[model samples]
Target: MDRTVEHYERIAATYNEHWTYNPDYVRGFSHAITDALRLTASDAIADIGCGTGLYTRRLYEDVRPTRPILCVDPVRAMLDQIPASPGLQPLLAEAEDLASGRVALPDGGPLDAILLKESIHHMPDRRATFDGLAGLLSGHGRVLIVMLPKSIQHPLFAEAHERFEQLQPDPTEIADMVAAAGLRSSVSYRTFHAAVERERYVHMLESRYMSVLGEFSEDELRAGIDQFRHSYRDTPLLRFDDHFAFVKGWVPAR
Candidate 1:
């Protein structure tokens, strides 16, 4: 398994803990996508790289309660956390496998939507992956790729922000990739706030809650945490601007 998958498998148990700090962040994103797609209870959806079913559960509960949804991820441990439900199906697979027909829709039909919620950055090849996934969409199916651009005006911390900027794909590049895959594409932005106590935020940082933070050495992680604590010493209720780029692509019915 790749380092990314291994890292997530190791942290699968605590992955859902993110909701505690920013309860509405993921749900807000889900609502935006569902609204943009005009999804209904009958629409078939897939949540790619759905770590611990964070957005998966929210999409089911808040948006499409009876929709057939597949939660796809490479790590079994992560998939193991998803609660069993009639409409929710958890599959162990990677993004590249989707295009190969290795990953199938829950109802054995074409999908109406595929969601890559903060998960595209982890894919090995963005262009090829998008091209492959586009083929799996139904005549009117859509794909929504959500990410945070490096140019975000504000992030949780300077170091983490810089790392995100370096790792995330450019919005234009993502749009081009989707368009190249023969789907009509557009990009939009959304902003949410991650509210947490300063002490809790520091603890999350120290634990390397995000995969991006895993790149830092122990010393670097410690230094970053110290800087954050020092910077927000006076702010008890710490709120950070969480900016996201939503890239939507769709093929018109034949």
Candidate 2:
């Protein structure tokens, strides 16, 4: 139980509303999770921190349903947002809450996929969390953790980037944490579509993640976002480059 997840538990309800689902974004990111899992019948996959089923619904549409897909999140409010679908099993459980042996499968086996999308940073104990995940995986199970880089490399985000730098995890540190979990895995990255749009991107940032921006004083937040906008005010929408990298890997087969 890390403080990160606890923080998410507090904001889970409004999180999804802030980041409206861009199907194109979901498809681009989820491709790796699906490709790594190589889903087929007889396989069960769980989307950890499956908030509002954004990616879950995307997976439901894109991937071939070989087995039941379980959507797991600690907050019930987030779980309640997931609309039911064929073979979609939405469960209310935090990352550390999966030890319940009662979780079942159609073939009475274990899970084949576990996706920790942008959720690992919030966790306090990475090793303990992954260790628990290892026990839940079937022989071929893989865990894919998707995340953004710690640094805001763009000039428009100078102030916000400064704060992000204070809170974000280092790549090497995160890699070391994963290795300490005693799992066999590899990491990869992909840039997001935001890599292209600066002004609209900043606007989206101001509108969508206001809570995150609001964490600072109103004057500071406004000054930061306003200055961020000014940095890109002359920048064209499509000309602005914003790429978010997702680090993905898997636990080797048992």
Candidate 3:
């Protein structure tokens, strides 16, 4: 199993719960997605690595798209969490499948929008992936990538930040990749906020809410949490900024 899939499997049950703790963050990012992807009435939309359909469900509710909203993910465990809905279609395929033509879209031709929120980094060969996705776009189709910066303001242990910086892809570089793939590309930034009870935030850290936290050993996690307790300002609510880098690519309308 892919290590990321394994990590999602371990946290699949709690993955949906992950959103509840950051309702504002969810709203901000989802709104940004709708605007960036212009999803008010997209004919066909796909959310690659649509983890448990947390954001997919939100997008569905907000946009109420007429056509099917495809939810794609490689991990069956995570894909299973997206409940049956009128317009939600769950596909068990990795991003590479779409890139390599191994998996076909419903219409087998064009897609109005393709989303790679927080999942682009997991794609092993992004250049080819971008090339393939660019080919899949309808006349007015678009691909939007939402990802993290190298550093974050979240109250994680110091080492977790280091690990994230090592793994996180620079958004400008990804935008350049899109341009090199022969599509019009642009890069932008969006910031969101999360306010949760301090204990809930601590639990999130313990749950290893992100991949960076997954790297810590059990003892290291405990120590990190302990440090967080001591170091973070003693307060009922934990508030922090979440920074998202957006890279958008599209084929010009023909």
TM-score of each: 0.92, 0.78, 0.95
Question: At residue 59, what lDDT does model 2 achieve?
Answer: 74
lDDT of 3: 0.85
| Best prediction by lDDT | 3
Candidate 1's displacement at residue 9, Å, is 1.5
Worst 10 residues of 1 by lDDT: 148-157
In model 3, where do residues sit more than 4 Å from their true spots?
none
Clash number by candidate, in order: 1, 8, 0
Q: If ranked by lDDT, best first, what sequence of candidates would result?
A: 3, 1, 2
TM-score of 1: 0.92
- Better candidate by lDDT, 2 or 3: 3
Winning model by TM-score: 3
lDDT of 1: 0.80
Q: Candidate 1: where are CA atoms >4 Å away?
A: 65-67, 153-155
The 0-to-1 C-alpha lDDT of every candidate, in the order given, reads: 0.80, 0.63, 0.85
Please provide, for model 3 over 154-247, each residue's C-alpha lDDT reduced to its tens digit, 9 standing for 90 to 100. Answer: 8787878888889888998999998998778998989887777878888888888897788888999899888888887667787788788999
Write the residue-wise lDDT of candidate 2 on 1-254 in tens digits: 54444445555566665446454656765675566556555567788878778777777666757766888777676677777777678877767667434444335547777777767766666767767776777766666777666765555356666777776676666666656665565556556554445655555565434224545665775687777667667766543334444444456544
Q: Candidate 1 on 182-234: residue-level lDDT in tens?
A: 99999988887777776776767766777888888889888888787788889
